[model samples]
Target chain A: MGITSGRGRLRTVSATAAVLALSGTGLVAYGLSKQDTATPPSPGRSTAAAESPSGAASSPPPARKGAAYAVPQGDVLDRSQPTRVRIPSLKVDTDVIDLGLQPNRRMEVPQNGKQAGWFTGSPTPGQLGPSIVAAHVTWQSKRGVFFELGAMKPGQRIEVDRQDGTTAAFQVDQVGQYPKASFPTEKVYGTVDRAELRLITCGGVYDGDSGHHLDNIVVFAHLVPSTAPHAHHTG
Target chain B: MRTTTKLALAAPAACAMIFAGASGAHADDGTYTMKLTDTMGNNSGSHSTATVHVMGDQLKVHITGSGFTPNSPHAQHFHGSFSENKNFTCPTSAADTNGDGQVSTEEGLPMYGDIMISLTTKGDTSPKSGLAVDRMPVADAQGNLSYDRTITLPAGAGAKLKNLHIVQHGLDANGNDKYDLDALGESTFAKSLGVSGIPQEATNPATCGTVSGASVGAEPTGGVDTGDGTTQGVEDVGILGLGALTLAGAGGAWAYRRRLGRQS
Candidate 1:
């Protein structure tokens, strides 16, 4: 009776092993098939970044000549709509557009991944609160403006050109990645005493079933008072 | 109880005065916003945005939130000590002095101060109604709550409302989806206030935010869906599948070898 039971156990183990082998082979084939179609540009290899006129990745672009105004002494700037955003290290330069909350109260993303949108609800780029700028990591198959957002490190420079023709320069302070389910809304959007900026984009494992990234990459930055001095275009 | 009665009686007179002075514009009459956030160490994923329209003594508060204890009454209040000149802000996990994982109302008082106004759905928006659970706004089936109410601020309440923090109370400590005393035991705040049989989950500060003067716009909840899975790393998936296939093949071969050996 003991021998018969041992043989039965062995048969069960063999059957389970065979099943795992079959599924594993199937999964490998599926992964290979996926590799053939998935050709989206990887992070830091954006064509837009390469084509930008300002090829230098270390220094900020020269300030556009306009009506020169005395740079404000404080970090905070008067409320002005942001027109463009440039990240020197990542070679990201994109036109800024306005974004509002969706009907569900979630932040609305840009129509495509190419442009970055400034949250209308937040304080303007150099204003005395957190200014939210968001873009997609990838739209459908194209790279987004913030595709390399997660790769950003502290001390990297981000410049936002305001509608008033003054540029708001910000120094990256910290970068964080959080699960979408537990996104720290307050830390990201809460009222801060100083002029700050938050850049957001999708990250983490992409769930094929949900067709969305599972995490969000947030970059925290503060206005660099020394670099904030720029001429406001009165025209 | 005395203060509740006094405020209830004084409410009508205040309304009459507001209506009489309706034509005159008050300089402080503007929109103020508060971005509510989690107060306790537990990442409850609860957050809310409140838009307060201050028109003279009348405050029309519209609060919308998601990820709270579903279908449970959330006791919210404007917490601050205006006369004492205390520093009012949201409490962090460090506020949990008792070493328990939760930050109780009493523990958070130092950071958020006392309740100045109870954000009840029906009546009595005073500190006396601080634990008026039945009167508070109840989250829906989806753990979302939207509250819109116009409350008459007490005589000196307007001046004190500046920079005050809004505290939204209630949490599901045991993941039971309902407020009960089983999880974290009885409410210390409620017991101190001479109320009993109330669960700590019903009174713990779940989300808190400082009120700031700003234009009214919806604050976003949760992380935004920023990717379309187009740029997912396929190489990683391929590598993972290859490793799994290798392991499975090795296991199957071993199992077959053992079975053949036993048969022989």
Candidate 2:
């Protein structure tokens, strides 16, 4: 699917939802209809819904910040879809699942505890913005896929194997844990000029009553320069 | 045996028992062990145990667990005594009233008493005790978490720990991440959050067990004990020797600089 065409469809979908006074549920229902077949709407075309800062991170602005490291110069991946992730340091070898937005506008967590999930609403793992992947810290008293995510030190590498015959490599830069109450929405979902990878999971104090983690552990990494050549940038 | 002879034997035994009780539920210098087992209806295939050492008002707790969610944090707490007409024991499959295939934390509450102390992560203590389920430190990469902490529990709470249940909560598969009635189907999460009046399947108690006195001088499995004083001394000496080496190297360098200046 063409990125330009996908953006056009998203604009149309958003307009229709607004005119119909769709609830969050209706909006998600519409979102899913358009999500699978098209690439995520690009940051270049500013949608009014995305411009709003009030909602669950509304929309991310265009990539205004320069990359901290040198990005691949040639064709980036065409959002070809990542199928699995392997982190040798973490001894993590798991399948990557697809996720979409919930009625709350937050990305749906991977339903399965064992699998890592990619946000279908964001760019694919090798895309130009922060491609989000998340899993539970623990599931049903069992540890989820990204359980040891916080222990990831800088310089460690994460590999995402895509449907295309290529693998996207990301080198860790920072791994920080923040309370869920003060989650850095802008920093995580904001637009960046290069392909970035974010692995997120619950951490901090576990509230037994609520059965949820109070904090979120985030691992930030950028695409390795060499892996960029293998990416087919449809954008 | 003669009555007088039997009384002589019984009196000393009774006196000794009284003296032990007067000392405290647990000796200040003694250690207690808590063996954890999977709770009723929740099968996670994890084994865990905790050892508590009471030193004055401070309680040192050492917890070791394996077969848990790899690198994840499991919310834990010491529930109130089972002596208050409550079972205070981990629930069983029969406790699955609604037939949800699993016994939730709320469903098992009648068996385990009120939460006495919440073993939370860094920075938070009582009052916000139960608030820690989500913010605690996580397990390591191997689905194992070994934690040790020294904290003061509520007054009299530590004394009753031997009769209390240590409960660990379960996870939400939907990833709504919060205890919501919509995703969890009107469970304890709703009651804790006050969204629902009645608790549905709130918190899921994955594993649970109780604390009991470990024999004095018995080989302690896990606790603040160093196993042997000699081993600890050796470690201290090693650290001190490293420090001494660094100081000697600096002194040697300084002496060489002075000699070089004199020759020049």
Candidate 3:
């Protein structure tokens, strides 16, 4: 009888010890998670983790931890221009380039390697003002970013990251397809507090003779948080 | 076999409850398949799939189609689904929540946007064109698109496409259409985009679990992308599950017996 009782006590102790170890391990794991989230990050991180209460955000763009916005002072120089965008919902991943007016006042294609340019005049994405990035529907023998712009819709995500480690996450508000002759550059690229981002591509009347789309597809998105600027870099 | 049985049994109740439920027949994801037809020409142009991805009340759409006339411009639209006894395309979600049911509009109720998808002509031509999504009005049961944008077609389109269906819609598979947040403030990806926030009726067919077979010749990259563009990495997932149901969890006692001495 004593032996049996002793065995039963051992089983109970084992179970208790297991529970204690698991709980301790769980606490440590949770602590690590907290540490990992101590500092907010750029939107491009694309991580899946538990959210911390109050969503500790970093600088300029005021989206939660994952998508931090930017504040551009002057023409902040960097190695690479933040061109090209990706939107999962739109299933678009394309390069961006500024489309200076052609002789006919149409957008131009980038001459170099997969480069998408931002309109120098506009506020870059992740910063104040509207960020305008344009790319060719087809350049040379190939197509460029925003090539499939017309296919995008609202509620999709558009991400533009700069070399300075700041990224702007643009949540599409509208996608408009208009004639290239009436590109509506002014309305599409208007300045606003919302950290708006617009993706422009050619569509509309496809002139088989000219071999280019006649109209433009414009996607509009606002900053995830336009009212609140983040505290900037965390850690 | 199991799913077939479940589907068959649920079909009747689901059909009955659909009308009894939401005033409007809406999909949680609001994704759809669009087939463009020129009633005037008596021709069917093309059919494509679109998912109006919603993020935090924001709606966006993603579209994919094969056999498209590259470089052609075609108008796009969202039309009302067919009413009962109306001769219309099959698989209209608004009228039939279950594939087995149908209802008519003359009964004083019209399903909104029974037909979804605006026409887009495909062909190569200089000078692009397309329409703003919001500008396009929601469709009523008459199969009419917003603004009667239906009168004409864009120039230069010729092709045949098949298998038009909304690939993936809704939030976290079986979860809510909005982002799922615990008291801890953790946000589910589904929540960041409002697709997860939609009501129960808007979900896509049960078979679409984020990973369905794609057509041949696709790059087969074998990695699922994380939405952010700057990240050049891909996560390898032989099984791309947005989230799948785990039916075995309810059997706690049996699970414990197999754990051999493992304690939670």
Candidate 4:
């Protein structure tokens, strides 16, 4: 019985090797044929569907040089307006309002402490470039929506629900505090290579003379891939 | 070599002719308003409006804004081409060099011509005078400044507001007591100004506007508030109420957190 089992195992190994060799040849031919096709390879067109279902199982597609971030794997959320923001770590959720330039040409702050204002002039939360959402740290002595923003740590998750059903998840990267006198307007409001978020609120010492805070607390974050694979990132 | 000298001499003659025409046109009286619009990408919420009443060489400038930083000084200038036929306009987003998103006063110069008058607190209003950015005044505690003053402009002062553009600077970016060319650039300038890694509230363009026509003594439309700084008492009460509510919310949150801790 042991002799018979050994012979059967050897036969099975041989069969497996032959099958693997054939598959390899077929793969090579498939690749050659793709190159021989009249149409050039479209880098923007993802080959995720043609590859293995598991992204880790397949060899990576050629990197698009000069591209800033990873190409999303599935459907990307459209440029819909954001309506609300929720940070799980802070246990805070608040409505959002559209903000425009004040007569002084400054960003108009949200009058209500419970809500935040998203600068409409900037990109939407999920679109490319930095999207800004500003709120008051304190209104009249009450805490504003972003009052606890400074306490948040890196890797905490934030979700902004948009006018569309889609919600863009964001992971916190860093938190910083700057005096109002030296606010980094360019860094906070400037263009970035990828979709970004900036949560701002007044911080530091309160100046009674100006009736404003001396510093502004900022939280920087980037979009987290949704469970549903998108065109840009792996799920 | 002779032709080059002749061209140089012709340049002076042409300049003299233009100056003569400007002087001749200075006597025409007209009322114009500078609706100080904010530049693209800066959202400081400042609204400044100035009415320039011209009567020959004497120019009466009535300046007002919603508010400025209580004690922060701002430098402003009347820039652009001052010509009878030339109509200068405010710069578009194309002026944002280096793509930092906010255009500085220097960056907008290509679109608007050179500075025409240095809107100084007190000094020379000559086109070549560089003191506009140096001698500006600080805004009051209420972010208000209402100064009704008559200043003398150079000959052909009537051409001054022909296509005037008002650019306001937030504060001395480098705090060097004067505006330096390098001080106008961001990042590097902010560092030199000792404001690196902080909000650039001190060095931003406060507000900007183009010259528009408005009647004399008329309240300029938009955001120029001429209120007599007496509205703080009622606002203080409202703020106190909000503060009380915030305290109550904090108390509830603390109790809830304590409960969660006990349970955990």
Which candidate comes out best when scored by DockQ? 1
**Fnat: each model in turn:** 0.25, 0.00, 0.00, 0.00
Q: What are the DockQ scores of the candidates, in order? A: 0.10, 0.01, 0.01, 0.02
Every model: iRMSD = 23.1, 27.8, 28.1, 23.8
Greater DockQ among 2 and 4 belongs to 4
Question: Can you write out model 4's per-residue Cα lDDT over B1-264, one digit (the tens) per residue?
Answer: 010111122121110011101112122444555656554324444567677777767788878885565566666677776664465555533355654445555556665556777777776766544333356666776766555667887778564563567766663344443334465444343455454542344555656676543321211112111111122222122222123222123333343344346546
Model 3, C-alpha of B10: deviation from truth (Å): 56
Cα lDDT tens digits for candidate 1, A1-235: 1323567598877777668656533333333332212122121212222233565856432211111111112457766889999998889999998776666567777777788888777778887668889877765555667777888878888999999989999988988776677778878886565678899887654544345555677899988854433323334
Where is model 1 chain B poorest over a 10-residue stretch in terms of lDDT? B13-22
TM values, all candidates: 0.43, 0.35, 0.28, 0.35
Q: What is candidate 2's local distance difference test score?
A: 0.54
Candidate 1 regions with alpha-carbon error over 4 angstroms:
A1-235, B1-24, B216-264
In angstroms, how far off is B206's CA in candidate 4? 42
lDDT of 1 by residue, B156-205 (tens): 66656655788899989889899888988999889988999899988888
Candidate 2 docks with a DockQ of 0.01
Model 2 C-alpha lDDT per residue in residues A1-235, reported as the tens digit of each score: 1324567598876676566546443433443343322123222211222243555665443311110111223234555678999988889999987665444344456555677877655557776557778765554434566666777878888999999878889888888665545566767765454577888776543322233334566788888854344334555
Off by over 4 Å in 4: A1-76, A228-235, B1-264
Worst 10-residue lDDT window, candidate 3 chain B: B217-226
Displacement of the residue B120 alpha carbon in candidate 2, Å: 0.5
List the candidates ranked by lDDT, beginning with the highest. Answer: 1, 2, 4, 3
Off by over 4 Å in 2: A1-235, B1-29, B82-87, B171-187, B195-202, B217-264
